[model samples]
Each structure stands twice: as structure tokens, then as C-alpha cells.
Target: MLNDTVSPDFFRKDAAFDELYPEHIRELSQMHWTPIDIARKASDFLAVPNARVLDIGSGVGKFCITAGFYHPETAFYGIEQRGELFSFAEIAKEEVNLSNVAFIHGNLTELRFDDYDHFYFYNPFYENIEPDSRIDYTIRTSFGLYDHYSRLIYQMLDEKPSDTRLVTFHGPDKQVPPSYRLVNNSSYSRVLKMWIKE
Candidate 1:
């Protein structure tokens, strides 16, 4: 069980955790990083003992680390396409001293969806076509790449067995396969959606 006191306030108070990155990266948290509250809630829902959970397009490992710490019984893995972000995630994981969280530097396409039982996604592909919300110019973002990734994820999720759990944050419902049915939603409405396969 996770300690309720290990909340956002607790993490934020730790200077090391809050200062994991430089000024620019820190500034991006409000827009890109998953909030601690959301991470805890999602982890609680998807964390089956010894189950594997994947964070699609995990930017800097914020979600993975927070969730892993709260739910130690479940292993959390993150796949990031950007090398720089992947590096930062590794360093932060070391600082936090967590062992269940791991990050891979590669595109989401390379991941084997069968390896994971549950998933957490934070609109990992939005930057591909949304010009205003682009994370950086380091990555190649185009409508074609966005469509490809979406289709890949949709198909992979479609193949998963029934009762597979998934949580999407600030993502379009269309990206999810129709086989998955909505289980519940946060009071925040569209921002956080929980689903389970039929």
C-alpha cells in the first residue's frame, strides 16, 4: 500500500525531486508533466500485483517514477523517442532511488505491447501535428507520423485480451480501439479517461 502522505506536496517539497531538471525543463512541467495526483490515481487503478505497466511516450519519466514509487508491486516501464529526455529520466530515477521504474530510449512502434498488461498515455502523439504545443524541434513531427503511431497503438490495444486496463490523459478517444469500453472518468471530465477491454 502507498502512503497517503507521499502526495504531490511531499514530492514537491523535496528539493531534489523538484530540481531534477534545469529551469526550462522545470517550466514545462505545468504543461507536459503528469501531476502527482493523477499519477497516483492511475497507478492505483492499473497496478495489479507483479503486473507490468507501460507509459507510452513517457517524456521525462515523471509518471513512471511517481507511479512506481506509489505502487511498488507493479513494475512501470517507459518508452521515449527522444534521447535527451530519456537520459534525464534515468538520472531522476537514480536520484529518487526507485528500482521498479525503467525507461527505454526508442520509438513507441518498437515496443512489444504484449509485454505489458496495462498502459498509461498522456497524449504522447499530440506534438506531431499540433504546431502550438510542439515540445521541441528535435523530433520529426508530421501528420503522417501521428497517424501511423495512432494506428499502431489502436491495433495493438485491439489485440490485447479482455479486461486489459488503460488510462489516457488529455487524449482523443478515437485513438483508442473500439473493443475497449469506458470504465470510469475522473471528475476533471475529458482530461483523464479510464478504460478496460470488453
Candidate 2:
């Protein structure tokens, strides 16, 4: 069913479309990649017409591409630390020919938090402290880095203007600033949390 053009509807239904990555990467999909349904829900909440949304640790551009498809008016940007993964994200984005989505290969520390209107975080720093959960040994993983990134994110979110939107998936709630109160919580609780700064 797949041809030159990548259809958003096909992507949502076909398992192969979601499994375009290698077996190893595909294996990580369930644990790491955001599901199509979840991405749709998150995108709807984050997309404020022309607002820009940033995925703090966009693994393979799944969240960005899916979000971009549903909300063409909103721009989605992803910051990925791993070079290989970043490359894959670029390739996938090209295949879809979506102008609203872009991927940057760099650490989250290099980005300016103020540039984005909203955020989607999927425990971007979790692999830093947990050796077993690491996607790969390619990047240096340390508790110090985890602590630093967590504190840095907390500070960034704290400084954002009121009404800034954020959606955290599989997060421990430590990285979120106290100033941002939980506006809505899914029955799934920890996995899906919607927050807005006070």
C-alpha cells in the first residue's frame, strides 16, 4: 500500500509504517516511541493553531511527525542527542514531505527554551542514571548529567511565562517546576499529564 507518497492515514494504521526503523529500534518503539493515538491527543492539546511545539528528546521524530500531520498549522521541532537517531528522524521527515516538522541533532542543553511555545517531554533524561534502560552506550550516561538536565529543565520551565503548556509522558514529576500546576490528568495518571504554568 505504500508508494512514493507517505500518507498520514497509512501511518496510523499500518504497523510497517511505524516499524520503518531497524529491528533494534523497532524493539524500543513500544517503550520509547509515542503511540499514534497518544501523539494525536498530545498534539491536539499542544497545538494552538500557529504555535510552535518542541519535543525535548525527540527519538526518531515519531512524535513530531505525527503531531505535525494532525496539526498542519502548528510547527513541531525535535532536539535529539544521538546522531544516528537524528539522521533517521530527518529521513523519515523527508519521506513524509512535511514542512511543519524539523529535527535538530544536538543536546537539549544547547536549545533556548524561550523559542518554543509548548513542550512535549518523554522522560528525556531517564537513561542517564539507569544503565539498563539506556538506548545505547553511544552517549555518556551519568547521574550528574541527569541531575544537571533535570535541574536545568526545571529552571527553564519555571522561567517560562504563565499559560505555557507542557505534556509529560512517563515522567517522575521531578523535572516539572512547582509553578506549573497539573491542569488535567488522564486515568493512566503518570504516563499522561497536562500542565499549565500559574
Per-candidate local distance difference test: 0.86, 0.85
Off by more than 4 A, model 1: 3-16
Model 1 lDDT-worst window of ten? 5-14
lDDT (10s digit) by residue, model 2, range 1-198: 112334756365536556667777777888788887788778878998789899999999999988888788899999999999998899888877888899999999999878898999989888888788888889998999999999988898899899899999889886898899897746656588889999
> What's the CA error at residue 152 for candidate 2, in Å?
0.6
| TM-score to true structure, per model | 0.92, 0.92
What C-alpha lDDT does candidate 1 achieve relative to the native structure?
Answer: 0.86
RMSD of 2: 3.1
Best prediction by lDDT: 1
